[model samples]
Target chain A: MKWTKRQRQPKLKEHIKEDPFVTDEALAALFEVSVQTIRLDRLEMNIPEVRERIKDVAQKQYDPVKALPEEEIIGEIVDLELDKYAISIMDIKKEHVFSRNSIARGHHIFAQANSLAVAVINDQLALTAHADISFKRQVSEGERVIAKAKVLEIGTLRTKVKIESFVEQSLVFEGMFSMFREEKKIKEE
Target chain B: MKWTKRQRQPKLKEHIKEDPFVTDEALAALFEVSVQTIRLDRLEMNIPEVRERIKDVAQKQYDPVKALPEEEIIGEIVDLELDKYAISIMDIKKEHVFSRNSIARGHHIFAQANSLAVAVINDQLALTAHADISFKRQVSEGERVIAKAKVLEIGTLRTKVKIESFVEQSLVFEGMFSMFREEKKIKEE
Candidate 1:
């Protein structure tokens, strides 16, 4: 019996959602497909394998706001093509365990969201002129957190962006960021 | 010449501003005293050194909202303990560097400030339901960032807090946070 492309895709999606964190070998066994096929499917679905997903999440969380060093960034794209304007992150590595007595530290998450928001603007240089954030939940190491940013309003001089961060699919931090584009120098001035 | 108790104590007030972040070495050298003496003076003045201050800042910036893990906090209490509900923090360390992209990964700063706002509430547990933040300037590592949180309004189920985070004696992030509080457990029918 031949499996239709439409049928196979839905089946793969269902399999992945059921076990969002699963190994390629396990998936290959369950689907009766080669590891290469499983990998190809995952790529098509924008879903990396468990280990790769974890690494992607961690690396994205820890990715710096800029590659260059300056007193401040006028406007630098950190997560280009993602259109995500802000970021939030956990400081400890995934190997660490959660402890009630241990605080995850707040600035790490806020900085992540804010930097992403700053990076999303269209300009050669943009600087953070103002920011505000609220922490909703405690985040621990190994927990998956994602930052979501939206453009609220954009103007010639300033653009406003809203950012929210979630850990384990729960909202943990929220913020609004504003960016100022550097003015161009006139040739005659 | 006899020196009075007031005269013997250094005029720390003159040298350090309210919510100031100073290094032990810097303080010691400035006063022409031993590091031990500076430490003792810091204790008396309720001022914390860079490391301790950073920890205090991180706690306010990074930790979860509903519960606080016990840890020794540094930084002098600069504002009046308002009866209406408020908390303030100063001098966030490496985390600040990340938020302003003064370093990298800047979202942590917003996370810290928002967490502190939630932690300062009088309720047993407070969860941030929504927030808006504005970034005013870039904050670097080792710079003092002060967070001031104030309750804007309170209702039966929700409370709103306004927070402002400052670095290098300048306003950097300002935010409004809305929180959900569970005052009593729901009874099952």
Candidate 2:
């Protein structure tokens, strides 16, 4: 996405609009300009620096766990140690449950756990190869669901992560995820 | 579309997939039949009740702003003070705007306001009691809509808040929300 300065500042804003975690250095490289020029352009345009942009995105209500801002992470990560462990919390509102039963849907619990497992990987480019998940118990609205993820093993091209979710210390869901982390070019070799 | 019970069966399936929020009463009225007749018609067609249909739809999509559990909320909140005030910002995307007109959907604005009103309540058990809302102007995708909410009054069981949304300096939406809060209590004893 190369752009002349005349065209780049606004385009720079749009790129960040789509992914606020993008660094100025990456923007500079993409625009084929010096990093300082990207910084200056962002400053002139009143866009915050990358870190601040991420923080601003984080501070929003229902702001999600955003390791990959484009990935649909359904919860908020309060703690993460890349590829080692991560934890997130999702509060179930009335909308999260079946109106007739008031029981939270199973997939929401899976999404929270699966998303955390994927988000905890160290690689910049990673994808979920497959996930094994179980719904141990029904969760209800007004409950804060906490999901914890631990990287069990890291292979050359695959990483293993386990996620467990609890509400008030009782297990409600569990998932094991195998993630793909190798680059496509490297895999071709 | 006009249809007898036999003709409505398959069409009912399609309508609920598109708008699961449609109630039995509404469907009955639309189909010019008694509510019980609608129930029998639904049973004959093997369609679940409205609540189940909604849950099914929610599980398959990136649904949020979840009044109906089929629409997505596009913002993050920078500030919130339960039962008093709140602030959030939504970056409109291509999907948020109409392709032909480039105007964001009216329901998205309403969702942002209604959800904020419910979210800002101090109680763990709160819902949108009612909302009196209006769109002040059409907003385009790529615009950041900043919504600020203020509590107008607080009653024993209900709180009233006003929300005004803006893109730049222009007002795009205004809403007065009445929210309900209560204890599950006559039983917490």
Candidate 3:
């Protein structure tokens, strides 16, 4: 419970690794140190902020995706709690639009939601079995689409996710996806 | 009906307008003229070939899509038979790729299938109720994806469409879409 700075730093690093989403304040309490000490320790260890840590964990944790590869996800997953909820962000760029109109292609929007649906499942193999989707409005280039997916139902072989994408305050797309998983078991953590 | 060149040209225009997908061979047989004559008539009247006509019709028709607008469909619909089948062609250009990898985005592919699924329905208002999809292979830029959608089942409120997309002979993507329509009524042509 009490250790010198030299001894605490290694344990702190391991703690953060085990729970990357752990906050500095939580780490301070766990390690019996000031929050400022945790921050200083993190700085010395080259650990990033909680937000960056979440992104890094999201990027590195999926082994790509439990369903596929990590690079296959359409957006940068900023927050993910597998089989519970996930949030991702995609900035519509020039490449994402129609050259003639500059309107963001609908698939880009769907992919973001679809991939999130897949990523949120706590399974080694997750695939979309069905999706009920709607394009609520047109998304143009230069907009940042923040997509949030929530697990609506979980079954032995299936899980359902509801994903809503927004460009700021306006809802741009919505989808409900039924996902197929290999089997029902607690994932090894 | 038999008619002079002057008479036939106007009739040909009318016929094409009536059925944009009508083949030259069919037109020749209907008009009792050689295929060459029909071609010549089309040439003189400034009407393009059937392939071009189909593209034009696919583009100009849909108002742009019965559910939304013409511009909403992801790819250019090359051939369509409302409620039966439809096809679209998308040449993956530079704009469709991630600048880092040049792989065509997943949404672009989905949009093509999703839009075709919407376009094939013979309803004034159709929306995707559900879709089961898979990415069979990674598609790169410069490849032309030919997507074909066929109606699998028709219900009073929902219709099922199976869409397969190919890069040459290799299957790149596939999806089964369950689409919802306003009601069971034949679209007035």
Best model per DockQ: 1
DockQ of every model listed?
0.35, 0.02, 0.21
Candidate 2 accuracy as TM-score = 0.35
* lDDT by residue (tens digit), candidate 2, A57-128: 555632233245433456877667787888777879887775645867554566577668767876544555
What are the TM-scores, per candidate, against the unseen true structure? 0.53, 0.35, 0.47
Q: Over the stretch B23-86, how does candidate 2's per-residue lDDT look in tens digits?
A: 7877787778789988998898888986566456535642133222213233555566655677
- In candidate 2, the residue pairs with backbone N, CA or C atoms under 3 Å apart (3 or more residues apart, or in different chains) clash, namely A60-B76, A60-B77, A61-B77, B83-B120
- The full ranking of all candidates by lDDT, starting with the best, is 3, 2, 1
lDDT at position B172, candidate 2: 83
Model 3 regions lying over 4 Å from their true place = A1-85, A89-109, A115-189, B1-65, B185-189
Docking quality (DockQ) of candidate 3: 0.21
Number of the candidate with higher DockQ, 1 or 2 = 1
The segments of candidate 1 whose C-alpha lies over 4 angstroms from its true place after superposition are A1-10, A13-79, A82-98, A101-109, A122-125, A130-143, A146-154, A162-176, A183-189, B1-66, B72-88, B92-95, B98-108, B166-172, B184-189
Evaluation by lDDT, superior candidate among 2 and 3: 3
Each model's TM-score for chain A is 0.55, 0.61, 0.64
Clashing pairs in 3: A64-A69, A64-A70, A107-B107, A131-B130, A131-B131, A132-B129, B64-B69, B64-B70, B65-B69, B65-B70
